[model samples]
Structure formats: C-alpha cells, structure tokens
Target: MVYLDNAATTPVHPTVVQVIQDALINDFGNPSSTYRIGKSVKHALIQARKQLAELLNVSETDVYFTSGATEANNWAIIAQANKSREFGEGHHIVTTAIEHPSVTNVTKYLETQGFDVTYIQPNEEGEITVQQFLEATTDKTIGWIAMAVNNEVGSILPVQELGEAAYEQKLWFHVDTVQALGHLELDYQALKCTSFVGSAHKFNGPKGIGFLVYRTYQEHNHLEPLLHGGGQEGKMRSGTENVPYILGMVKALELAKKDITSNFEKFEELQAYLLTSLDSIGISYEINGDQKNRVPYINNLWFNGNIASQMLIKMDLDGVYISAGSACSAGSLTESEILKAYYPNQSERWSQSLRISFGYQTTKADIDQFIHTLEKITKGKIDLWHSNK
Candidate 1:
C-alpha cells in the first residue's frame, strides 16, 4: 500500500519497534517501585527525559510524559486557564481558528465557564499572524495557544512572532507541536514559548506516548498538576511512566533530529516532483492554503467538486491511501472546519479538499504511484480537475 496520510499518523520505524519490544520484555518493572529492577527502569526514564531535554534544549525537569498529543493539549489549555485564575487575570484566551480540535474544543468548553476566547481567523493562508494574535489580545487575556504547524494544510504558523509577543505582554503561550515534530526544528529555548506539546507517533515512533515541555521559570509553572495519582512527573502529571514507550519515543526523536536538515531538503525535492507530476498529468488543483508558507510534508488541495469523501474511499479501496482532512474527523464526511476558517463562506472549497502528507520513508516511487493512481481515477473527469484559474 502507498500511504500518503502521514499528517494523520506515521508507521513506527523498525528501530523504534525493536527498542520498544526489547524494553517490554526486559525492562518490565514500574518506575515507581523501589526494587532493583524498578530503580533501573526509573534511571532509564530519567536518562530518556534528559536526552529529550537536550534535543529540545530545555531542562530535564521540565519534560513530562502523557498518553499523547491529545492529552497534552487538553492539559495545556486547562492548566493555563487555572493559572490565569491564580494570577487574577481576565477569563480570556487567544488562539487561532485553525487549531487542532483538542485545542478548539477546550477553548469552546472554557467559553461555557464564562472565559471569553478570541479565535483569530486565518487570512486565506491557514496561518495566524502575530498581528492577529496581538489584536485579539486584551488586558484580560490570560494566554495564547496555537499549533506550531497546521496539521491539515501544513501552514507554518508565526510561532516565533507569537512567542515574542507573549513574552512582551507577559501572557502564557502554548504551542501544539504535533505536526512540527519531525518537519521543523524544535528548540524550546529558541521558540521562546511558555510550553509546547509533542506526539511520538507523528515521527515514526510508538503511539500512546507523548510529552509536554513547560518552562519552570515561567509563572504558568505554578499551576496545579493536571493529573493526580502515584506522584509521577514531579506531581505535575501523575501516573506510572510508560517506560518502554518512553525509551522508544526518545530514540525516534533523536533519530529525526540527527538528520533533520537532509530530510527537509529531501521533502522539498519530493514536493517539487509531486507538483510537476500533477501538472504533467493535467490534473489541475488549487492548493488549499498558503502555497509557499507551508511544510512540504503536507499538500492540501481543493479539486473541482465536493468529491473528497468519494476519492478517499476509492483511493483506500485501490490500495493508495489518502485522507480528506484531520483523521479524528475524517469519518464524519463533514466540511473541514480548518478549510472553513481559511476560506470563509466557501463550503465548496472546504468540502472538496484532500490532505496528502509525506513521511520520512516516502520516496519518488511513492509519488509516482500516487500521481499515476490519481490520473487513473480522474481520467474521464480530467476536465473537471482542469481549473480555469
């Protein structure tokens, strides 16, 4: 099967799999136990935490593990709100309309609790600018949270700009780095955000594992723990650690970071090849978001009609896998909220979008097969894909 839905999730690398398998059988003791095996496992967790901290350029104490990006995202928003209450700040939050559902839903729930949230809309680019964030901010606004890179359209948000703005305004900042993990360089210090969340599954690692990095020096650090049990993660996030998955996750991330530059260049080459192939095949498509300001990993496009669901079904049956939008909402056949936020009042555009993402193992052969399959699928209806503009 030719898989192009990497933005949704990636297959685990062989090395990561091996690491997890080994730990599962050999390092089965719980980190919270005081016995010899437990102490050794606990030491491994400590070392893994330190290793990840070095990769992100943060202190080891700041890294806390969770189930995945979803949990981390939920914790970030709620914890930030709780911190706002502690500081006596206004019940207001600043976030983008294109944020992951994990974030958007949390903000929506917060609104029900009397916390006003200003969701800044993207300007036809799937990107939120610092200016928009600043304009949305008020004296009552407690924090700003946004994804470092949009998962659907792959638009790279202005994280550096927002981080600086958050610093200047003394407001908390949380970045969802799920899409940014393997695609973009992760420097917690350089990014200057109060906190950032990551998922291991996004970068060819095991699923059911992720981490959150919150700066200890920041005022937001004083917020109470999001989870309470077993006193794990310094009482900030409680629960016995998934030791094996933690080791595998750290391994996968380190591997990605080790070759980030070369991988980025390779993805650029692949992206250019994909567009050229589409042009050569006479399959005209309008890129769904900012053409030049997106990660090469994801290519979201809007074809002629409301055929995203149909094409996705056909592609899956034919062994060439792709997706309409975010995997969490892909089954619903509903219009993409992300696309709607980018192209307001354009239901046709939102409904006819496809998100094709690339992984580290993706190759020119995969792209060739995808273009060939797409051409075969749209043969008689080729003119429909041939846009005037």
Candidate 2:
C-alpha cells in the first residue's frame, strides 16, 4: 500500500521498537521505586530526558513527559490561565484560528470559565504572521498559543518572531510543535517560547508518549498541576512515568535528529516530483497553504469540484492511502476548519481538499504510483461531475 498519511502517525522505527521491547522485558521496575531495579529504570528515564533535551537544545529539567501532545497542550494553556488568575494578571488569551483542536478546544473551555480569548485568523496562504499575533495582543492578553507548523497544511508560522514578541510583552507563550518536531530545525533558545509540546508518534516513536518543554522561572511558580498523584514531572505533572515508551521515544528522537537533514532533502525531492507529475497529468487543482514556506513532507491539494471523502474512499480502495484533513477529524464530512480559515468566504473549496504527507518510509516509486492513481481518480470524478452538470 502507498501510505501518505505520515502526519497523523509514523511507523515506529525498528530500533525504537527493539528498545521498547527490551525495556518492557528487562526494566519493568518503576522509576519511582527506591530499589536497584528501579534505580536502573530511573537512570533510563534520565537518559531519555537528556537525549530529548539535547535534541531540542534545552536543559534536561525542562522536558516533562506526558501522555501526548493533547495533554501537554491542555496542561500548558490551563496552567497559564490559572497562574494569571492567581497572580491577578489579565484573563485574556491570544491564539490562532488554525491551531489544532487541543489548543482551540482548551481555549474555548477557558472562555466558559470567565477568560477572554482572541483567535487570530490566518491569511489566504494558511499562515498567521507575527504582526497579526502582535496586533491581537493586548494588555488583557495573558498568554499566546500558536502552532509551529499547521498539522493539516504544513504551513510554517512565524513562531520564533511571535514568541519573542510574547516575551517582550511578558505574556506566556506556548507552541504546539507536534508536526514540526522531526521535520523542522528546532532551537529551544531561538524560539524563546515559554513552553512547547510534541508527540512521539508523529516522529516514528511509540504512541501515548510525548513531552512538554516548559521553561521554568520564578514567575511560573503558580502554574497548577493537571494530574496529581505521585508528584512526578517536577511536581507539574503527577503520574507513574512510562519508562519503556520514554526510552522508545528517546531512541526515535535520536534517529530523527541524526537523519533530519537527509530526510528533509528526500522529502523535498519527492514533493517536487509529485507536483511535476500532477502537472503532467493536466489535473485541475490548486495547492493549498503557503507553498514557499510550507514543509516538504505535507501537500494539501484542492481538486476542482471533488468531494474529499469520495476521493479518500476511492484512493483507499486503490491501495493509495491519504487523508482529507487532520486524523482527529478524518471521518467528518463537513469542511475542514483549516481550509475554512484560509478561505472563509469561498466555502466551496473546503470539500475539495486532501492532505498527502510523506515520511522516512516514503519513496519515489510510491509517489509515482500515487500520482498515477490520483490522476485516474480525479479525471473520472471530473468527468462524472461535468456530465451531471
């Protein structure tokens, strides 16, 4: 099968799998225990934290493990909001319209709790500029949450610039880097965000394991804990850590860091080849998102007058796997919020969109097969629509 839905989740690397399996069998002791077996597990956890810290160029203490990006995001946003309340700061939050549901939904929930939220909309290119975020900010704005790269369209936002601006304003800045962790160059010092979230599954690691990079400071002392039990994760997140998955995630991160440059080059070549092949087929389509600034792995296309669900179903039948939008909202027949944010007035294009993403396992042969299959499916759909018209 030609799998092009890597943005949703990637196949775990063999090395990562082996690491997890070995840990599960040999290091079953709890990191919180005081025994020798537990000491070994604790060592593994520390090493994992060190490796992830090195990968993102951050201190080991800053990396806090969580169930996934969703929890990390919720923790960051809600904790900041709580801190604002405790410190008598503003109750307003600044975020973008194109944020993943994790951020958007949490911010919406905050609104019900007497907090104000400003969702800055993106331009036609599916990009929220630094200026847009700056303009949205106010004295009442307590924090800002924006994604480093859009999950559906791969649009790279001005995260570093926006984070710097947030720092200047003394507002907490949180970035969801789930899509950017493995695909983009991550410099924790340069981004300057108060915190960032990432998932292991997005980067060829085990699922249900992710990390939050929280920059600790005296001002953030009032941040509330989400899960309170064992007082783990620097007392910010409380739970018995999943040592095996953490080890697996660290191995996957190491591999991704080691081969990021080569993988990026390969994805770039594949993206170019796929676009050229689509052009050769004379297909009527428009590329969604900012083509110039987007990541090489993800390509969102709008095929004229085509229903994304139908295309996705047909492609699945033909052994070509792709997605209509975020995997979290895949089965929904309605227009995607990401596309709607880009073209608010032009609603017709929303249903016509599909997201094709690449990964380390993707190949030129896979692209060629995908293009051929897509050309056939799109042509047939166009013919059927025209005949009905």
What lDDT tens digits, residue by residue, belong to model 2 across residues 11-59?
A: 9999999999999999999999999999999998988898889888888
lDDT of 1 by residue, 48-151 (tens): 99999998888887788999988888887788787776768778899989899988998999999889999889875455789888888888988899888898
lDDT agreement with native, every candidate = 0.85, 0.86
Worst 10 residues of 2 by lDDT: 380-389
Model 1 lDDT vs. the true structure? 0.85
Q: Give the TM-score of each candidate.
A: 0.95, 0.95
- Itemize residue pairs with steric clashes in candidate 1: none
